[model samples]
Target: MQPNSVSPASEKQHIVIVGGGMTGGLLAVLLAEQGLTVTVLDGAPAPVMPTGPAQLRVSTLTEASHWLLQNSGVWEYLDMSRVQPYDAMQVWDQDGTGEVLFRAREVGAQSLGWLLENGHLAAALYRRAADYPNLHWRCGVAVEGARREEGRWQVRAGDEQWQADLLVGADGARSRVRDWAGISGGARDSGHHALVATIATALPHNACARQVFMESGPLALLPLYSDPQQGEQRQCSIVWSGWPERIARLREAAPADFAAELQAATGEALGEVTLLSERAVFPIQERHASSYVAAGLALVGDAAHVIHPLAGQGVNLGLLDAAVLAEEVERATQSGRSCADSAALARYQRRRRGENLLMQNAMRGFQQLFGQRALPVRWLRNTGMRWVNQAGPLKRLFASQAMGRGADLPVRARPRA
Candidate 1:
C-alpha cells in the first residue's frame, strides 16, 4: 500500500492533507489506515522539540483524545514518561472566592486528563506517521498556489504540483486551503492576550491542575512531569491571560520580575516559582469558517474553527474533527459510497460544524460569565459555581464534557456505552 505502489482501485481516492503539523500528520496516518493514498505536504521539516527560549506549549489530553491516539496506533509509540496525569482539578477566583474542586474519584475515573508538551505529541505523531506505508511525506515544501480541475484538485507548492481526488485543510488558523477553496471565516478579537511560560515550583503538586481567575484574567498552572535533572524538582506550565497593555508590560519585564508577578498572580498556588523559560504572549481571538466543505475539499483543525482557550479545548476539538472526518471516509467506503462524493463530505461537515459551534458558544459563554467585573454579577457567578461544585452529578457532567466524552460527541466518536 505504499504510495508508489498504489494501483487503481475501482475508484481510487487520492487525498492531500496540507500542513503537516500535529493534525495534518495524524490525519494522514488515519486516512492511510483506511486504505486510502494520502500525501502530507508541509512547509517545514518534521516536528522537533524546541531548544530556544520559547515556552513549550502544553495541551490537556482528554480520555477520548488518548483513546483516539491509541486506536490510531500512536499511544504505544509515544514517550509516556514525559506525559503526566492529573486526577483532580482546582479552580478559584483570584479574589479568593468561588473556589471549586473536581476529583476523578467522584466520577469513578482514574485521571481527569493528561498534560503533554505540544512538541512531544507532535514528534510522536510524526514518528508514527513514518510507519504508514501508504502515506507520502513531502516535507520542506510550501503550497505557493492551488486550483481545482476536472473534479480534482491541482495543488502547486514549491517546484511541484500535487494532484489529488480531494484535499483536506489542516493548515491551522490562517489556512491556505481554506482560501483556495473559497471558504470564508468570521473572526472577533477577544481584547486579551495570553502570556505562557514554564515555572519551577517547590511543592509536590499532588497531580492536580489549578486555575485561578483574577480581575485581569485567568491564570492557569498545569502540572508537568518531575524534572529529570533534579529528582524532587517540580514544574508547571503557566498561562496568564490579561489585557494587551498589561501583557506587554509583563513580557518586557526582567525574568525575575516576571516570575514575581506570576507568583503574586497565582497567589503562590503551587509555592515558590522560578522562571524556566522566556515568557511568550499570544493574542486571544475567535474564528470560524463559513463552511467546512465544498466541492472536493474539506477543512479540519484550526482551519475550520477556533475558540477561547478558557477551557483548554482547542486541540481536543481539532482532534475530534480529524477523528470524525477519518471515520466518515471509512464508513462511506464501506457502504459502497464515493470517498470524494459531495454527499459524504457534506455529512462530515455537518457533524463537525455543529460540534465545533456548540463548544465555541459554550466557551464564549463561560468566558463572558467569568470575565465580568460587576460586583453583583461576580457574586452571582460565584454563587452559581459554588452550587455547581456542590452538585456532585452536575460536576461529573461538566468534567465529562471537559474530558471530551460528553453526549454531544459526534456520532462517529460515540462509544457503545
Candidate 2:
C-alpha cells in the first residue's frame, strides 16, 4: 500500500517500535512493506538531510547494510553525495611493528563498507517511510511507560495510550522499552572513552580506512568527503579511545594541540590534522540484553547489544538485527501466526544471539590482548597480526567477514546477483 492508500489505524495489524533510530526505522519500513502496520515512536525529532561535512555521529555501514538498504528501496532516497565508501582497511599496532590489511578485491567486492552519517541514514529512512502506507511515525514523543495486557503491549507516552500486537525496543543503549519488558542487560565498562570528531588533514585519506592500536586504545580514521565550500578533499572522521583522564585531557586541549596529538598518534599518516567539528566524547562499554524477545516484545540495535567501537561494527550488527527480525516477523505473519509468535521470535533469537555474543567476546578479548603490557603477550599478538596479514586464505576470510558476507545472511542483506 502506498502512503495514500493507508488503512485506518483500527483496521491494520499494528506493531509499535520505540526509538526510531536507524535500526528501528529500517525495521519499521520492512514490516510495513510486508503489510503489517508499523508505528515508530521516537523521543527525538526527525533528522534533516546532511548539507555539509558529516556530523560527529556517524556509522560505518557494512556492505550488507548497504545492500539491504538498496534492496529495500531506501538507498535512492539517501543523499549519496555525503556517503563515503572505502574499499580498503589498514590496521597496525602502534606499540609494535605489526599490521593487517584487508581489501575488497580479495572478497570479489567493490567496497568493504561505507562511512555514513547516522543522521543521513535516519533522514533517508524517514523520507522513504513517508510513503509506507502502513507506517505511522511519531517523533518527539517520549514513551513514558510500557506494559503487556491481554497479550498486547500498551505504551504510555504524553497522555496517549498506544497498543500493538508487537513492540520493539530500538531505543538505544538505555532503552525504556527493554526495561518495561524486564529484559536483563549488563554493561561492562572498558575503562575507556571514545572521542569522535570530523577533521581536515593536510593529506587526503585516499578512500582508505585506517586504525592504529596504541596502549591507550584503538584510534580509527574513517574517510569522509570534504565540504564543497572547503575546495579540498582532505577531511576524515576520527574515533580515538582511551581512559577517561586521557580522553578528557585530549578533549579539553586546545584545537591545535589536539590536532598535533592526532597527527602524532596516527604517525602523521594523513599528515597534519585539523579539527573541523567539535570532538564529542562518550563512555566505551559492552552492553548486551540477555534475551532479545519476550512475548509480544522484541529488541533491536543498541538496545540489544553494543560492543566496543574499535571495529566500527556496531551499526552493521544493528542493521542485520533489523533484517533478520523483519524476515522472521514476515514469515510468521504469512504462516497465519501472530507477529509475536514465540516460535518465530525464538528462531530470531537463536539465529542472532550467538553471533552477537561471539562478536562481543571477540572484541573484549581483542581489547585485553592489545592492552597486555607483557613482552611475551605483545610479541605473540604482533606475530599473530603479521601472520594474519600474510596468510592469503585468512586475509580472504577476513575480507569476507568485514564485507558482511561470511555469516548467515538475510535475503535482503545478500548482494543481488
Candidate 3:
C-alpha cells in the first residue's frame, strides 16, 4: 500500500501515547505500522532497566496474546529460549486434600500459556519499535496533565505543551489521562498481600504451574527456564497470599526459614525450595474504570481495568485492548475515516468495555467462591471443579476462553471462527 496521502496544510492527526510500557509501546508500533505518526511520551526508556530494590514480576502470555504480538511484529524478535511453556496446570487445596487439573493436551493446543519476564518482552517490543520511522520515541519525559481544547487534545508534560488529535492513557492504575478524561473507577481490597519471590528447587518442575488454595487465599508457583549461571538450577517464582499478620511474619523471616515455610505451604509440590533472592509484596486489589473513552481520549491496560492475579489475566487483557483498538483504526481508515473520528472511537469503546466487564465479573465470582470458608461451600466447589475437569466438552469450552480464543472476543477480534 502506498503511504497515506496528506495535504501540506492539513495536520497529520498526531497521536501522543502517555506511557512507554507494554501497552503504550505496542499501540505506538501498531498505529505507526498503519501509516500514522505517533510519539510515545514516557518518563522511562522502552527497554526499562529493573531497579535493584524493585521486585521482579513475570507475565503469562495466552495463545491470543501470542497472536497479537506476532501480528504486531514483536514476538519474532523475542528470545524463545527465555520463555517457558506450561502445558498443564494443577490446582488443589492448601492441605493437599482436593485437586483439579487443566491441560492443553485435552483441548488440542500446544500449551496453555508461556511464562516470561516482563523486561524481556518489553525489550523485544522496544527494539522492533525503533525500526519504524513513523514512531517517534520520547523517553525520560513526564506528562503533567491533559485537557480538552477546541476540537483538539492538549497535553502538558514537564515545561512544554503538546497537541494531538487524540490522547491515549496507558500510564497504568494511577493514570493521569483517565483522570483528565473524567473517568471514575471502583476498587476492592481483598485484605491480602502476595509475597512474590524466586527460589531454586531440587526437583524439576517439568513445565507445570501449580496453585494451592487456602482459606486465606491462593498460593501460585510458576516454573521458569533455569538461569544460565546457576547450573542444574530449577527456578520457580512464588506468589503466596495470606493475611497481613501472616505476611508480616513471613517477610521478617530469614531467607532459609522462609524457604522452608514456602516448601511446606506448597506441600513440596515442586520439591525442596531454597530462597535465591529478596522477597517482594503486592497488595491485592481490583479496579475498573467507568468508561474507556471520552472526547479525543482513551484508556488501555491497567489504566482501564484490573483484576485478581489468581488467574494471571492482567497482561493478557492489556494486549487484547491493543489488538481491538488497532482493528478499529484499520477498519475506520479503510472506510475513509480519520483515526480519531468519533464513530471509530465509539466503536472501540463499545466493544472493549463490554469484553472487559465480562472478564471482571467472572473473576469476581471466582474470588467470592474460593474465599468461602463454609464446609458445605468448600465441598460443593471442589465437587463442581472435579466434574468440570472430567467433562471433555465443558473443559474444552472453558480452556478456549482461557487461551483467549473462541466467541468471547468482539467481532473484530475474532480471526475466522
Candidate 4:
C-alpha cells in the first residue's frame, strides 16, 4: 500500500496538538520551528507569570530539561529571580540513622537541579511559542472531539474544526485525546495522598533539598527562593505523602497544629516551620498507556504515563517525551517521509516507553521498600543507604541519573559542543 505523503511542491505537514500546557506547548514550538504548521487547542486560559508568595505546585528541572528550554529559546522568557537552584540534596530514613548526601560539586556541576513554579514555566513556554509564525496557540478552546478521516486527523472545538496530518495528546492524565483515539490505559491508585504547600522555615534551607522517609511515606522539603525584598531565604515547598486519611487530616488541621506536626517530622532540622500558603491535597496514582502511539496520534507527558512523585522526575520525564517525539518527527521529515511515519513513531515509543516504565517501577519499589515495617528490612535499607553514600562511584551514578544525564538524550537535551 502507498503511504500518505506531503506534496513535494505544496505546503508542509500540519499537526494539531490538543493541549497547551508545558509538554504540548513545547512540542508546538519544536514542530513549528521545523517548518510544520502547528495549532494548539487548550481548554484553559493562557498562563500568567506567577507573583507574590510561591505557588503550591512546582517542578524540579534537571540539567537535561534546562538544556531543552535553553536550546528552544524558552529559558530567556522565564524570570530568573523566581527560579531556585539547589546545589545539594539530603535523603534519610526517619526510623533509622541512615542518610545520604549528594553535592553538585562532587559531579563537577554547578547545581543538582532547579525548582520552578508550574505557572512560571508554562507562561515562559507560551511566550516563546508565540514567536513562531507557523504556530497557532489557542487557549480557552475546549476540544470537543478528534477522529481520523481520510488519512488525516480532524479536531473539533465548538464551531471550529482543524485537519492535520498528526495529532498529539498532551492533555494530562485524563486526556481527551487519548480517549478519542481509543488508546488503552488505566490508573492504579498508589494507596496514598500528598499534601503540598509553601512553608517558611525558622532556619534557611541553605539551597538544599531534603527528604525523610517514614513508615507512612516520605516528606520532601524542596528549597524555594525567598522574596528578594525580604532578604531571607527561609521559604521552602513541601510535599508530604501518606495515607489518604492522614493527608486529609493534615489539610484540615489548624495552622498551628500543622506547623507543630511539620516541626516534629523534620526533628527541628529546619527549626520551627510555618505554613505560608494554602494546603492542597492530591491522590497519587500510577498510570501507563499500553502504547504511546497509534495511527496518526501520539501521547506525551502525563497522558502517556504517571508515576509516584518521590523523585520529582514527573515533569522532567514529560519534557523528555516531547523532545524525543519532536526529534523523531524531524528525522522523518528530513528523510522525505510523512511526519506521521509509522517507523518514526515506533522509534519514539521504543525509546521512551521502557525508560518511563523503568522509572515508574523503581519509584514503586522504593515506596514499598520504605513502607515495610519489618525490623530486618529496616536495618538492611538503612545499611544500604550508608554504604551507597560512602561509595563515591555508586553515589555519582545515582546523582547522574538524578541530573538527567544519559547517552540516549535527545539532541536538544545534549550539552552544546
Clashes of each: 0, 0, 0, 0
Q: Write the per-residue lDDT of candidate 3 for residues 282-352, one digit (tens) a residue.
A: 78777889888888787889999988788788888888787777778778888987677778788888877
**Segments of candidate 1 deviating more than 4 angstroms:** 1-13, 49-55, 408-417
lDDT of 2 by residue, 8-78 (tens): 44543479999988999899989989988788888898777887557898888887999999988899998
Q: Which stretches of candidate 4 lie over 4 Å from their true place?
A: 1-13, 229-231
TM-score of each: 0.93, 0.96, 0.92, 0.96
Q: List the residue pairs that clash in candidate 2.
A: none
Candidate 4 displacement at residue 101 in angstroms: 0.2
TM-score result, candidate 2: 0.96
**Which candidate comes out best when scored by lDDT?**
4
Question: For residues 1-417, could you state the per-residue lDDT of candidate 1 as single tens digits?
Answer: 112322332333489889887777778888888888888878887676444332469998887887778878877766677788999999887653787899988877799888888877877877777777777777677888879988888888655677788899999899989988888977888877998888788776788999888777778888887776434427788788888999999999998888888878878776777888878889998899999999888899899998988778888888888888888888888898766778888888888898899988987776677778899988887887798899999999988877778654644445435
Q: Considering only N, C-alpha and C atoms within 3 Å, which residue pairs clash in candidate 4?
A: none
Write the residue-wise lDDT of candidate 4 on 45-119 in tens digits. 988889887989999999999999999999999999899999999999999998999999998899999998999
Residue 195 deviation, candidate 4, in Å? 0.8
TM-score of 3: 0.92
C-alpha lDDT (0 to 100) for residue 409 of candidate 2:
89
RMSD of each: 3.0, 1.9, 3.9, 4.6
Worst 10 residues of 3 by lDDT: 1-10
lDDT of 3: 0.78
- The residue ranges of model 2 lying beyond 4 angstroms of the native Cα positions read 1-13
**Model 1: how far is 20 from its true place, Å?**
1.2
